[model samples]
Target chain A: MNNNILEDLELFNEIIKEFLNEEKTTPASKFISPENIMKEIDLKLDKHPLDNEKYKKLLKQLINSTPKSSSKHFFNQLYGGRHSKAVLGDLLAVILNTSMATFKIAGPQVIVEKTILETISNLVGYSNESGGTFPTGGSMSNFMSVVMARDKIDLSINKRGMSKTLIAYTSDCSHYSIAKNASFAGIGRENVRYILSNNRGQIDIISLEKEIKKDIDRGLTPFYLNATAGTTVLGAFDPVKKLVNICKRYKIWLHLDGAFGGSVIFSKNLKNLVEGIENVDSFCFNAHKTLGAPLSTSVLLVKKKKYLYKSFDNDAQYLYQTHNKDY
Target chain B: MNNNILEDLELFNEIIKEFLNEEKTTPASKFISPENIMKEIDLKLDKHPLDNEKYKKLLKQLINSTPKSSSKHFFNQLYGGRHSKAVLGDLLAVILNTSMATFKIAGPQVIVEKTILETISNLVGYSNESGGTFPTGGSMSNFMSVVMARDKIDLSINKRGMSKTLIAYTSDCSHYSIAKNASFAGIGRENVRYILSNNRGQIDIISLEKEIKKDIDRGLTPFYLNATAGTTVLGAFDPVKKLVNICKRYKIWLHLDGAFGGSVIFSKNLKNLVEGIENVDSFCFNAHKTLGAPLSTSVLLVKKKKYLYKSFDNDAQYLYQTHNKDY
Candidate 1:
């Protein structure tokens, strides 16, 4: 097995070097249709393992045919291009293959994740009482915020079903995950009020306040207000400072979805994009987007750390052997 | 940037070669206390980038101190030891760095994921209507099942809040994610009835039926029945064949969580462990667990593919640029 790993790594080096060279010249690899995919590359998994030579050849073909998102010409989504250092870190993670759920099992790797969360928390101007976790993606991060908000507004909602018509607010310009998350959280898609956005794609505060007042008139309990740090289409940052006052007036949990442009916090000039981030109840930003980290490196931070534990904590004797809080 | 990537790859090769040698000699990496982690390795992230030499040295120190999960002597989690081929594939994925959300962006990679899902669907005896998606992990897979079941039982549950008193049944020995998912789905954790397990660690069917009947008698709806393929502690397979009939009589959605040992279906000798799996509403297993792939390669398959779309299909014009169904 050791020899096999070394030999494969050698093959990987050769193929990646060739692929990188091609990326420099062509940038975008030739796109193969779905129907012609099987002909272009052998993707079949068989009962028996193939020889090293055959396996390496097939792998080279597959890698050559894959889309070159790292190429300079490729610009389809929010994430593009690979950072060399970040890629190296990801490759090491694959080699280590450790689960970060428990401290005893993951060891220093847990600290590695914690350091990232802590740094991001501080960058958002959160106090020592703040805490965060890396969810799977931007969608999951948004979903976690909704769940936490729902539980915080009505503690019995987790143990007992929602007794009141709980409402949530987000701009129409926000990511589509808000509606999906609303349905997933059993709040119902109809319960989510999508306030209209202005021409610049920022949330219309007047319209938002009107909708909240309307819901309140109907005897509905409004809980969460999802502000967008970076709207998906226009790349607009909502008026966070203005929205903070509105959220406070309504006593709503304010969550900022910065999946598209949250890395502005790292930039001196762009920091003003999310000026009132410190006052928000929770904030999430995808490191993979602007930071050039690997895909799905989303960070979710909560002002008061206990909400994360309250919403996600579940006791399993077999898995969580240790009783440490940090883990 | 190209030169930097090549240099980093070279550094990666050297460090990995040394790491592999250490694994062969001493499989378990040295453990460092959380308190001493900062002193042991330079984990701090700063504003300025370090020089290549210093950066590489720090990376080497960090990787050396990290837990050796892939080593032969490591027996901490169910996922131990790494497949060299899978590692190669993961490294290639990192290099490609494509988002798998849409066809235009992902291209042939979509076909690769489809092939794996199709094969798994067939292995579980799913018909042409069957389909699957690679969720982030086993916990997310189970959560999807709950959400799907919730939406399927009452179609209005998605657009409107859950109006009925819906109850779900699971074994006491099942994964802890069941309760967490229930709370996330707004089903209420108390609504998930934990049927006691027998001495063999399989769910007691008699108690399960009694709970179902009692829920129905109290004007409550029994919507989901989660049967464990392999109980986390004892590795016991529940009587799936018998539970199918009970689910059918109650019209409950039967979901099999094979996160721990669902790969038994791949073994001809052990295939009988998950007998009558074809009748299940949904099934999920972790390829990363028994299959020796990367950490979070979980596959969720449904008997009727439309349920997946019904629960998770949120249209984003900016994302799904193409209208093809296969994407």
Candidate 2:
């Protein structure tokens, strides 16, 4: 390694040592209020680069003030602790810095991603035809599901803008991404029928069916139904098995948002929460949340792989030079 | 630090040392063909965890078989070379692992992101009211621009599905994401008017105007015009200043996709390539490209900050607990 990389690596090791010691003693770092952040630490990006010592000092100070999400005491959201293996994987990924766009560039890294997706598919009881890809995060995975559902219902929607009012059903307890994704997919936020959730925070099957029927009666296309594997607040799992029939009868695509609790599939005792996962048109989960990976590790799986290509496949001559059949 | 962490860190140092040594001797590693990838690397994910020694061995094997994206000889895409400072930043981010959703959780990290956005906005000559956010990648930044443009022209599209035939124009030489983003935004891929590029690969100004006029004559709403800075196949820059009048006349939102070459804003000489960047309604670029940050670092800036919230803001009581006005 060159002198620059060696110096940076030494700085990294020193900082990590300090961080680990702090975590052991305090667990949670001192929280700096948003208003006082500028006074607490120097966060400026100057035209001239800082010297190695100054840069290291500034980085350590900034890190000291920032929230310790990986610490045991930090529990603000759905994700917290960092698995050692996962951290190792992330460090390696940063060092590799490969773009997984094509096989030619990514090589075996593509196989690694594919294997993880396939393993998840198998866990969900999906068929050999099932396949998936890693989106940026839960919101994007939800967005992709909405777009695929729209295209499946009306293939012409991909070619021509929406002419029919496509209605989607989701419980009020579901992730907020559902409504946002609806708007993104051009279905309109108002078109998403927020079904009433039971006291337990699960989607009421009757309410979902009622909303679907009402939309159909209004001559609107009931295209998608989003069921939560684990709701945001109550950590409630929607009745996935019960909604399967409703989706089948109404011809609406069913998607399971396992952003908060989808990692339950990894557990033999808890996999029953998503009992009808195989029957759902699509499913997504954040490994970063329950699997203790780094932030933004989301995977989206489809029952039939063709829908993924149908919705997202766009050709560019320059990017895809390889003519591999598997990819 | 725990024994596990120490062991992993030691292993990481060892692997990185080997990687650097290999990079020096052979800048580009051997390229394994797609068909031979499986035979070359053992990528199976077993149910039980491998022993520490076995795990380290497997990891090294996997790393050896993978492509050396950070090496000097690896130049498959728009990005390469790992800047020591950027690598340090990414490592710190992984350790912190804080989500930038709200001020309470992210704290100074939010300010850091905001500062970068503000600096970029100022560089583009945007006013104090201008702001931006970090999306997942270039494709997503482009997608957000499309959605915002669609909502800006007709706000009702967010509430009611598209009743109007909205048209978008982009150069044929632009990134392939334009058509895909159009489909995602509900404008339909066919609705994207692919204006022919001149012999130099820049968007033909006359053809763009002609398409806009033709669409207007057909009672279609021309909502967005995407100008490219450093197109995919040929590193061509579209005439940003010339398109300003056309977009103004049509009342269309102009977005600059600088995914491949927006870093020129930092160069005194090359800044003239994107001369009228200040007039654009929205602008985006991938820091991972020319800036040499890690993969998937994209920034999207908007001239008017309110339009971001207008298009993407949705409330969830559980996630956004703090009522900070700045966030």
Candidate 3:
């Protein structure tokens, strides 16, 4: 058993060294011949175990064929690059393999996540009352914001579902996640008014207010406004300050979908991109994007901590023991 | 930089060796004095880098102090122990750090996940059209199943937001996630009729049918039925075959939350526990529980692929640039 464990570690170390060196020259796999590889690798699980030598060879082949996302040359999407500390932190997390649902299971990891959220919340100019949690991805983060907005609009929505025709406003140039999120929130995709954007792809503030006004005039409830900080296409920062006035006037739950461009809060020079960010009810940004963390490290911060409890808090007697509630 | 990387690797190697040794004897964390550890670790982010020796010292302290989930003595939770291959796969995933949302970005990883889903679906007697995805956890998996069932009952629910009074059924004895998931799907905690379980913690099929019948008479739409393959507290398997008869009679979508003991499918001796499991509309299990994989390795498989598309699929032109239609 010890020999097997050592063999696996030695194999991993060798692979790590080879991967780091090769990634410099090859970021994307040379060719993605799926059919050919499927035939060669034989991913099917048989009843009996294969020879250790064959298994090791197969592992190496699989590793070599997979795309190298850590390399600097890999720029296929918004999230790229890697940081050693972040990698180390995630590796340790996997080794520990604790569930992050409750404080009892996650332990100090809960505080670690909370501390990071608190820091990001502070950077966004949120008050001490602000709090957040990490969702699975930017889409899930955005979806959670929509859910919070929906439930906040009508607390009974959690109990009775949507009783009114709810309207959400997003720019035409914003991430497509808004539409999907609206769908998830039971606010039809059609209800998401795609206000026209200007040449720069930022939501045209005038157009946004016009749509909100029209929705209200039509006897529809204008409940949510998703302003993009960095849109997927042009990476445009919306006029957050300008939008805040309309949100306040209409009692709209303002959510900043800063999933892409929200990282500018880290740069003292570029923080102005999301100026007046604190006024928004909730804000989300993917740490995996722009910040060189691993995938699925998105944070969702809300101004009033009560909203999170109001939206997501459900009683479970078994999981939340009294000893676990440090926060 | 090379020296730093190598030193980090060596430090990791030493830690892994020590952890493996200690795990044989000690499973649970010896102690958890968070406040004291917080002071010693100095988790506050400073303006400049701390001393290398101090940083390494802090990292080692953290590794030592964390709860040992992989240890043999740690039988406090459903997911314990670790497979070396699983660890290797997860570590490589962190290094690759690719988002699983789109096929274009994830490349072969997309196929890898899909293949796993396909394999699991086949094991559950799902046809070629059956499909699934990896949610953040078993909770998320259960939530997805509810959403799919909701949407399937009234295709308009996705767009119109639960026009009908929808009701869901789950065993009295099951994972606490069901209540949270019910609230998440806008079905309300009140709407989830927890049918009483027998002495073995199996759902009372007669009681479940009685509740479904009562709800139908009262104008409530019986949309979903969640049966537990393994109850968290007792590891009880619900009478899935009996539940399926009622589900089919009422045209309700049946879901098997096998989050705890779903691996019985692999055991010829234990497979009888979940007999007639293939008839359920959807099923989910945590590989982390029985297979000794890492946490968050839950699988949710549906009888029909369309429900996955109906609930979760949305257009993201910027990210999902073709080549990922396996689902």
Candidate 4:
């Protein structure tokens, strides 16, 4: 090993020891205000470089001050805890510094990601025609699903700019990303119909079907419907079976925003939460949540592989010259 | 340090040493076929668990076969090299695993990302009104810029699907992501007018203006124009000052696709390449490129902060309860 790496390894060891032992034990550290932490540490970058001793001290300070999301006491965020294996995988990826845009540059790393997506697709009961991608987070995954539905509804939307008042339906209790994703897809926030939820905070199928018919009666297109596997507050799973039926009847593209609770697919007992997930056009879940992976390990699986290409595939000659069909 | 972490650290060091000493010194390793690598190691995940001894050995084999992009001989991709500090930062980020979405959850880490973005924004000569985000990659950054421009042209596009024939312009030699972004923004791929380039691979300003005028005469709304800071093939810098004038006259949103070459903002000698970048509505560049950060450290800056909110902001009550204006 190089001398510099040895020194870094030692320093990192010290930092990790402190983070795990000192920070992880305290609940008060989890609520440290950003302003309060900034007062204690100089985060401001200056013109001159700090000496080795000072740099090490600053790094230690940063590790000390940063919120301890991996700690047992840290529970402010939707994603908590960390897996050593997943962290090792993430660290190796950083050291390799490869982009997953193409197979030529990424090599086996592409297969690693593909394997994970494939496993999740199979768990969701999708067949060989299904595929997925690891978006940055749950929001991007949800947003991409909306884009695919929009394009699928009208292939001309990509060319002509919105010509119709297309409506999207979601449980009023679903994650806020649904409305945000609708906005990103050029489907206005007003157009995203927030159907009334039951006492369980799950989407009321009666309200959803009624709203779909209401939109159709108003001469507007009812194009998309979202079913949440785990809601933000109540952790309720929408009636995917009933929603799938409504989607089939109205020809609306059905999507399951399983970003929070979709990991239930891994459990034989809990898989019933999203029983009709196989019928949905697209499904997404974050491995960071429920499962103990690193944050942002979001997976978006589509029933039809064609939607993945139609939504995101762009021909960049310089980057994708290898163009293998297997990729 | 924990016993498990110490063991894993030792294993990681061995893998890194082998990668640097053996893999980094050769060119053939850079071109290792995916199939060949698969033959050397098992990638498929099975239900059975491997013992610690077997698991560690398998991991070593996997690491040995994986392509080492950090190697000096590997230069097939646009991003090359790795900064030790960046790698260290990324490793720490993985261990902490904090989401960048909100201040409450992210805490001090949010400030770190914000500080980096603020520094880059100032480097591009953006004012107090300027704001930025670290998108997942060059394409998402470019796509976000298109979304901003689309919304700026007509806020109603988000509410009602495409009703206008809005036209966007970019040099024929620009990055492929621009055309893809247009399609994503519901501005059809056919509508993205590819202005002919000069022999130097720079946008022909005359052809651009003529195309803009022609599109206007044909009753198409000329709303957006992208000036490439570095053409993909020839590395040509477009005449930003000239394009800015046409954009101002036509009331079009001017975006600088500096994904490859925007790092020049840090070089006094080469900053002249994008001299008129300050006038553009938005600019993007990847720190993973010339600056040698980890892969996907792309930066996107917009002239006005409202456009960022208009394009992306969606309210989620559970997540953004501490709605701080600083973000």
Candidate 5:
């Protein structure tokens, strides 16, 4: 046979193998069985993607056989443990992946979101205008508080740029996320101005007032105050009455980080812990924390739905196109 | 009968009806129907400690009637859409509730958090020094990025205050939360510059570079850039490579809000969109968004671990309890 003919036949075999492999193997994998036609990846040194067949199969099998995060009883995190009716909803969401930026795209998810938000808003004794989105956690809920406060000070932050030395206040016992939030707002951690707390870990209102006065004296702007519903450290509640009064006096935005204890709203006896909560601008709780829901179920609600729009009302196309269409 | 005695007895009857209502009912109607006098609540709203007979019945009914979210088809929000496996683990977490802030208090939760974080860090191709925490959502995640950026610019922000003239950039295609985040951090929304994007919705890098320089020339501090992946808009990805270089040149902190798109780290085909992701100073994603996990399953990670500590490292009592002594 001519050398050219032999080379052509070899090329045919290569193409056949390529077709078969491409249809079977994923880009990455790790197989446990020694003889399972896996991709030929060098586990010891080759941590990179390769074209080895045996190695690929082996990797795929390994990954497939790894403990299932959804099925295995490994609920060490703050979210899911044993899903119930909610899992059905979760799977349905996957088959119909959609965003929450609009009502039309999300369809039922939108209704569900609104209903859930309404249920929570009602629990907080908010009026019809009260509403919020499903943030990922308590920390993010707190983050929402800052956003609202910022908006109240200057709507242009969403447009032109910042103009004031905006300030935020939280108890020393507050989550570390608060100071982190302050930094994120470009407020510099120093501007967060921690207020000393009572023995029970609740905010010390006197210190808060003095500090706000000091900031005013120093010409630093003050705009928001965060009150803890149930801080992470000790399940402590701030004296909501005093804080509300101070916020009212200064016309500051009030936010409650009720991630863990917010669900206490469900128990009549426990409701008093968050007394005077209605006076605040916004509140949120982690349904996953005490309500026995899955993880990542933190709800951020405002006394008025308008505040959410005021804080986070950007309308990006594709996600919000349906929301933008005229009637 | 005496007037007081008649009132007490009448009150008792009302309380029983209150506990039996469908809205207030738990355990469930499956065990006992009201027709059979099986379902009931308290006779009074102010009853102390609740009536034992009715309370136990309610508990029993709650445990039984309690619909399982894992089993049903309910997809309202991120947290409730929990998986059964994650739920079981979460229940166990509650039976043995522990915090994950450190190894001592958290033990396994900490390990799990660390493992999950490591897996995510590896997916983003971060170096060994990369670090992060399981935050609440995209908002807090964005906020963390801002905080880290602020501190990196001038740690003095931690003590001084947000520089009112500071400039940060996010796309018009981005989430409204970014602007809110900027507002909350003390830099009023005025400081948040929403750069419009192209037809595909990617941040216009040319405009971004121009703005940074313009801000500097105008005596404004230009320090942070927020690039969205899987934008709330058309699932657009920012020009990460170009932005990373500009950030490098200008010494600005670059944050990639990959809340919806970060999950692509598990998919090779989609991963390239975030190609130059490693160049960003911080990254965040929502597992609940694409991973089919329950809500509140969100995270925030930093390429440089020091940034997390620099911005949020805090000391407190209850959470930082006196080191445990061998009992």
Candidate 6:
């Protein structure tokens, strides 16, 4: 709005145009040396190190980043394909800066996240009672699924205290996240039993069943099982239907770690991969992955509604309670 | 592009505007029934049972999505703020669908993410060997740090196998995710010893020293000691400088979990809270939290760059090796 700001904007436009022209002549990345690039840029814009807050300094910073995770050059993990539309939604989201913890601040994102979860639920064949939340990613989703399992099967654990002797099961080939989830949720890693896996990376239901029995024989309470839809090392799908049957019979809480492949529901061809998902207590996947959202758009859909509360219901006086005057 | 398309665009624009306007009218914490909200949207969108086809159905979905996370009165977790510019970048990222594993697929994003990492490095005061990556969230960041510690302290453990005698240390007030990380990384929860916390909720350093001595006396391998910054429940900060010294003297890998408070680097007031962060083998934080990036934009910066490969260099021939040729 000021004359100085107007002058700066005009100068900025000219310098940007000059840089674009030079880049068109020789791709910006070709000029490797920081000094050379700086010198070249200086010819277009007035170089004054004294003006530390100038746009050129910021522009220089915008150019020289290494490792380049977003640049297609930095592929270290799964879910690398970034989504522009999803990114836009996230941009809109941050500007809005609303939390999903309540009914109002998260107006549209709440509906969007909820609807997306519902879409996923329909794909997974959950009933009207099924619901979910947009956690940071698949890892957090798995964490929630584990907590839900622990809470449902051992409802008294939170109040009476964790049964240190309790045990849970997942396949050897499944993600290592589940073990961590159990440890964090107060189950202690000692209680989490790893069931052996088949050569194809599927959970050996027989082995899992035997482990549960063995743990019970050892006088440990058996509570939960996490069936992976796809393992990180190998794209492995667990025998979800078979695993669910065993859990149902044994009264263990069953949930699916479908973060990588849960989006397979979108592909009719891949839908069969998660056949027993409908039978599980909960399921989750990353939209940032196969579903094409920005990183962190992960969802956890539950078959039973009450379990989510059992896991994350922090009854702080300032929040969650219905008595807040601001609310 | 066409009159039909134009008409549809107008309808979409009108609908989104109306939705935004209506959103401003809603009261926070009034407890709007999910069913009633869903019904109202259904009335607005008027989904015809007869409509068929995947693409159109997905369009209907876009129309129905909750647009803003903040507008819904949601704030359950730490990193719900969805940034607009970053989201725009993300959408462009998804549409282009570049694999960041290599420069050939994700040239621009790789450049962008690399720059982002560098900015983080400068903040943490790591000049040369400092390195990091954008993992899913705090849990994975913790998981990777554990993996790095395990590989750095004991290489044979990876090739030979995990020893039951190995142990890790964190405060009783630390995030649940840390215990999970230890267990998932194969140390087992039994090996993760929880140190007692003082009244202000800092990790008891004297107790930590005692436990490490006890573990060493018993011939157990004490590999990792995690000092948390911004603990979950109490938002507590550990004494990083002391922990770093102890870790250095005992040859233990020290990690700082600043996933929540790492962004305090930008604040002159809070930066000193993590005074000795540079001495630790690794440190991690989520930009999605304090930096306002969408979920899962977590960065794990390590003191020794080589440790990064030791932890996550598990990429096989098909998925990663081929992409290596691009850069």
Per-model C-alpha lDDT, please? 0.87, 0.86, 0.79, 0.79, 0.63, 0.64
Give per-residue CA lDDT, model 5, range A167-261, as digits (tens). Answer: 78999888777876665555556678788988888888888999999988988778998888887767789888788889898888888888867
lDDT of 3 by residue, A1-327 (tens): 222455667777887878777776666775565555577666666668778787777767767777666678876658558777677777777777877666555566666777788888888889999989888888888888888888888888877665578888888888887877776666777788889999999888887888888878999899999999888888999999988988999899999998999988989999999889999999998888887788878889999988899988766676455454543
What is candidate 6's lDDT per residue for A144-258, written digit by digit as tens?
7776676576555444334345567888777767655554455555567778888898888778888888878887778788888878778899988788789878898888888
Instruction: Give stretches of model 6 more than 4 Å off.
Output: A1-94, A97-123, A126-327, B1-99, B151-162, B180-201, B217-221, B230-237, B267-270, B292-296, B321-327
For model 6, what is the error of residue B116's alpha carbon versus the real structure, in angstroms, after optimal superposition? 2.8
Ranking of all candidate structures by their lDDT, best first: 1, 2, 4, 3, 6, 5
Residue B17 in model 2: lDDT: 83
What order do you get sorting by DockQ, best first? 2, 1, 4, 3, 5, 6
Q: Write the per-residue lDDT of candidate 6 for residues B36-119, one digit (tens) a residue.
A: 665544423223342424434454443335434434344454744444444433423332334455654354445556666776
For candidate 2, the docking band is medium
lDDT of 2 by residue, B87-139 (tens): 87887787788888887777788899998999889899999989899888888
TM-score of each: 0.97, 0.98, 0.95, 0.95, 0.62, 0.60
DockQ (Cα-based) for each candidate? 0.67, 0.70, 0.51, 0.54, 0.13, 0.11
Instruction: In angstroms, give how far residue A187 of model 4 lies from its true place.
Output: 1.9
Give the chain B TM-score achieved by candidate 4.
Answer: 0.94
lDDT tens readout by residue for model 1, B150-192: 9999878888876667899999999889888888888899999
Best by DockQ: 2
CAPRI tier of model 3: medium
lDDT of 4 by residue, A50-149 (tens): 7778888888777776666665677664665766666677777777777676676667777788777887788788898998888888888888898899
Each prediction's RMSD to truth: 1.7, 1.7, 2.1, 2.5, 15.0, 8.8
Query: TM-scores of the first chain across all predictions?
Result: 0.96, 0.97, 0.95, 0.94, 0.74, 0.79
Where's the lowest-lDDT run of ten residues in candidate 2 chain A? A1-10
For model 4 the TM-score comes to 0.95
